[model samples]
Target: MPTPHRPSAPPAGRVDAIVLGTSAGGVEALTHLLPTLPHDFRPALLIVVHLPRHLPSLLVEVFSVRCRLPVHEAADKQPIQPGTVYFAPPNHHLLVDRDARGPSLALSADAPVHFSRPAIDVLFESAAAGYGKRLGGVILTGANADGALGLQAVKRRGGVTLVQEPSTARAPTMPQAALAAGEVDFVLPLEQMPAVLRAWGDGGAI
Candidate 1:
């Protein structure tokens, strides 16, 4: 495989939150990534993984056991907590909101973008607007082009963007689409992601 890409310069600031999006092969991909985050990992993680709209998601239960950090299905209006991982509930669109109390999660029933309700684009775009340069956006394996524009929005707002190396992905279309949209900070294999995320969360050079 080709060498992974890294940014020319280290990121400028701490990443307060990370927005992750995926679909096909997402469960296995997340299993590899999230469990590697140390218990004290500083940034909050908001994740969107495509799921059957009618069935309840078991992501929280599944990851809570594997990850050292707290994991929950995102609740409407729940405050974003550092070190925790929140997955968008089935059938709902997850978004980021900021208010006097600070940043929180928001769920929407509005029409899906790219035919997925918990669309990667919805979460990524909202996080870009809410957290701006303090946010980090990651696009992993998926079958379609859901996350491309959202990752573009992250780059436009001066946030850090990362995509799984397309050749290493179980389903490459999503990552490929994200790469086609524009430049990103990194294109890494899943094995390398946790370290970079740790560096970003710790406000250190990667």
Candidate 2:
């Protein structure tokens, strides 16, 4: 396992949104993290989890029951709302775009990255571009290296970056790859993530 870095405080502004990416044990990992978020937690959450292209995703249904905030499958041109969680639908690349109305969700069927549509890199990179310093990127447990470069992009854009501690991950490749690719603000066990995120949502320094 890589040495855990001390948590770095984000720049002097509240984060407006967070992008989370995962695969493999993602459902279990998210269960541990999202359910703990308070109902009034600020900041919108956008998520990408690798799923079979042929199958419809049930993430919205699953999480809506478990989470305090509203959960939905992301839709093209959907307006982003704070305190909500949006999951990328299977077979599309979820992206963030800003227009006159502010940041909104965009979906694309462009070629897959790392052999996965709704690739973590796609979502992270686009969210970094759309939200810039107001974005937060998190790479969780996964079987592939899909989120590494995306997390780097987030860092490059002056956004906060975090990874699930590889030592505690069910499939450590994604988190380990993210740590190897660039510096991260935090590397934490799943049990500790909710508190950190709650702090972020509360506009408190990490």
What TM-score against the true fold does each predicted structure earn? 0.94, 0.93
The list of candidate 2 runs beyond 4 A from truth reads 1-13
Off by over 4 Å in 1: 1-13
How well is each residue in 78-180 modelled by candidate 1, as lDDT tens digits?
9999999999999999999999999999999999889999899999999999999898999999999998999999889988989999999999999999999
Model 2 lDDT per residue over 73-134, tens place: 99999999999999999999999999988999999999999999989999999999998888
Prediction 1 global C-alpha lDDT: 0.93
Q: What is the clash tally of candidate 2?
A: 0
Backbone collision count in every prediction?
0, 0
